[model samples]
Target: MNASRTPLFCDTVLAERIERAEARLMAECCEAAQRGDSPGFVHVLAGGVASFAEDGSPYNKVAGLGFHGVPSAADLDDVEKAFAAHGAVVQVELAHLADPAIGVLLTERGYRLESFENVLGLALDGEYEPVALPGFVIRRSGDDEFEQWLEVVADGAAHPDTQGLPWHEEFPREIYLRAQRHSAAAGEQHYVAVRDGAFVGGAGLRVSEGIAQFAGAATAPAHRRRGVQSALLAARLADARAAGCDVAVITTQPGSKSQQNAQRQGFDLLYTRAVLVKQP
Candidate 1:
């Protein structure tokens, strides 16, 4: 680890690159719904995509907008219509660096600010100190443990720590479980934190275009403050860096313990996204 600060500028090129990779992941996650008793749909509008997991689902929203090109007022109209057709709200996690005019267009079309999420980044141009927790064993999940991983992750999500911005909506545990299944179908690398042969935490990672997305993670309710998540994060960071990614990005609730933990691990705030919604 470098004692000095890491230099990373969140310029348009960087933002665009990150945004595109993330949006592709979202769509890929949705694409997983095409398999085995899933209830998700994906629609491409202009350049971006809208995904529907279920009516009123948090996964039902638009993403990747204003990236390939600035979407027109009519383009947004079609986007809204696409989600509306499925009885879902038109939601967009618009990056602050996106064309200012696009945000203006969304506002003019009635999308209201609902919340914000922080994106922390770590430049992997150098080496990182290895991390190991004494009481926990962290490793990649096995094929036979998919159900176990899903149960652990969904359980943790159901009992999220109260240390960050509260979720905008409360999803059922089943929703989280289904989400993990989709992530698996999209080829996300899964990791588990085990203590005494029991899974205490689970997380996922996906790499695209030299950027590693800490796709999602959660710690079990009974294991919240025992450093399980930190251990998992450190392992993932080192692995991602080893995979040749130039930078890693993770989205977290503003002021979340997750965000705090990431900051301690050499990741800094690269950007914040405004979550906007237009009810259907």
Candidate 2:
């Protein structure tokens, strides 16, 4: 090991990119909820709770209830009943200023808060300085190497606790394949870090609406502590800057290791999202 080598961590500029990605992710989730898209339904699984309910898909389930301009406790009751029928867990997100009174009601009833994320951003054209890893190598993932990436992700997420909220096993596979196809169709970019010919870590960026949203970040457990993730993040930011994006963002749970990593990379906190859970 080189005595002068610096450990892997995020910087200020990279932090901004994650922040921007987070904002886009949150906005997308909210819109999905509003529109009752599959992605949106998954966010709130209140069964048939809303007066106006939209159904969900097999892969990413979602349903919309309640019309605008009218608030009803039945909407919450419907959601609770739905969760009971399915025994499913929903990821409920409410805007910071919207209303926590609802979330507070659920928390008082014994629902877990689970995890939360913070949104951060930075200009895409900004300069990015790489953290040092004397002997590590970074490169873009190859076309036929999807399984490798999946395996790396699976390996990283092997621990039950690391898996976060539970979903059917097939759900992640569906999301992963959809992401791959979306990336190819949209000409997205993915980067990976390799050590001694082993694929150890990865990161990706998708350009939409002239904004580059970063996603698909993972690192093999054994390869952590090396500069793999940091390098992948730096390279992704550099790629975003070159693509003419003005700013980048990322959303992460507050006080998570991911949040600490983003902060160490120099990302400032833009906003925090509060999640609500209602079990029937």
Candidate 3:
């Protein structure tokens, strides 16, 4: 894979850019819930917000802090208390763009480094050759098909290869459904891969600030190795490019098959981010 860099991947700006994007997305989800367009609630914070579902959603977490500068100890203390009030674990995703001192502060405050995710990006300045999965069809999903799309995605996520991974927990069906609805309400584009009119895989795309992010992508167990995901990626990238995005990004576990697939498709490592958590 090419190691070319863009402003979004620059060491000095990468963290903040990612944090901003995440914060924006989360805030939008909160708005959707407040408007009764979806399920969930948003708790505004000093520099970020806490997102929660009526049922426990691991998605409930804090984001977009320590970007302008390292947060004060008192500020961190308050943030922890706020998350605790919501009966949620204090989880934070710190990126390289954050002030280096933020890590030191988190460590001092009882947060443990949980895991790392490789952020990969692909520039959409050139022609993209669409991958053809001979017997599969990929298309954007509509509101009426949300449940079917969620089922396929949840099944794909539960595939054995994804078990025990931080990102692959099997939440209650209600939680998944609510989250999917909230995501759609927040403007995420859902896509599904089908063969013979049956769902085989699914993915989600969110575009902002000239960038398109492949937020979620998975293929059913029986559909693995059949280029289902590649076809989905191709379709999403083409759609994003046509919509005027200059870059496309995705995150995956380091050294996983997903990461390998992304690399094969011209995505390069932008940075690895740390997921930190403090249990009550």
Candidate 4:
């Protein structure tokens, strides 16, 4: 750490950069998933991307909107039509820092409020030390261990910690696994935790545009209250700094355990997004 160099803080420019990176990653995941047997759909817009991973899949939504100024009505129409083609509802995650006019447009278009997600950030300009976990081993997952990692992560997601707001909905186990695979294919780095030679937790990290995205992570039901998640978070932060990321980010249900964990790890509440939905 340079004593003379000032620490990084979240500003409009930084927020926009992070949000745009997230949007791009979402699009990439959609494209990567489409290459598989599932055959999903992706719609690219000037403001963001709309994706449809599968029927009733959580990836079926629009992200990265309102940052490039308000999106045109015609573009929104096109996005809606794309999802409607699959008999799916159009779900939009709009950042609060975005142009307010975009929210107005969505309201006029009959998009109703759904939920909010908080995006927290940690500046990676300084050094990050590895987290310590007694009786636990943590390391990046190998390609051959993907199935084991997926099983642990899915089980963790199915039974989230009760520290904060719950998720709006849950996807089927198979669909969730597919989403995880697509994320991995989109350059997400996977990390696993083990205790007594058994996989106990799994997490993911992705770096794009100097941003390290702390993707979803979960611990085995029996591993909660331990330092598995904190260790995984630290490991990713250290790796992201090594990768030269300017900031690290994670999104979670407002006030959830994930949010609490990030905060405890020195992350600040940078901004939030409103989840709006319009049915076909």
Best-fitting candidate, measured by lDDT?
Answer: 4
In model 1, which regions exceed 4 Å deviation? 37-40
Candidate 4 residues lying further than 4 Å off, grouped into runs, are 1-8, 37-39
Over 1-280, each residue of candidate 1 has an lDDT whose tens digit, in order, gives 3569655778878888888787777788777775655466777754667787665455677776666677766766776777777777888888887777778878888989999998889888877644788888989888799898888888888877788898666777767677677777877898999999999899998889899999669988888887888888888888888899999889998988999888877788998899999998
TM-score for model 4? 0.95
Q: Write the per-residue lDDT of candidate 2 for residues 24-45, one digit (tens) a residue.
A: 4443433444453332332332
Clashes of 3: 1
Candidate 2 ranges with C-alpha deviation above 4 Å: 1-87, 97-112, 129-132, 159-188
The regions of model 3 sitting more than 4 angstroms off are: 1-9, 34-48, 160-170
Against the true structure, whose TM-score is highest?
Answer: 4
Superposition TM-score, candidate 1 onto the true structure: 0.94
The residue pairs that clash in candidate 4, if any, are: none
Residue 17, candidate 2: Cα error in Å is 14
Model 3 lDDT tens row, 1-280 = 2345343344546555656777778778667655763355565554556565444664666777666666766766776676676666777777755677878888988899888777888878876655677888888888789888888987777563553245523567666666667778888999989899999899999998887879768888998988888788888888998889887888887777788777777887887778888985
- Candidate 4: Cα lDDT at 254: 83
Instruction: Count clashes in each candidate, considering only residues at least 3 apart in sequence or on different chains.
Output: 0, 34, 1, 0
- TM-score per prediction, in order, is 0.94, 0.60, 0.87, 0.95
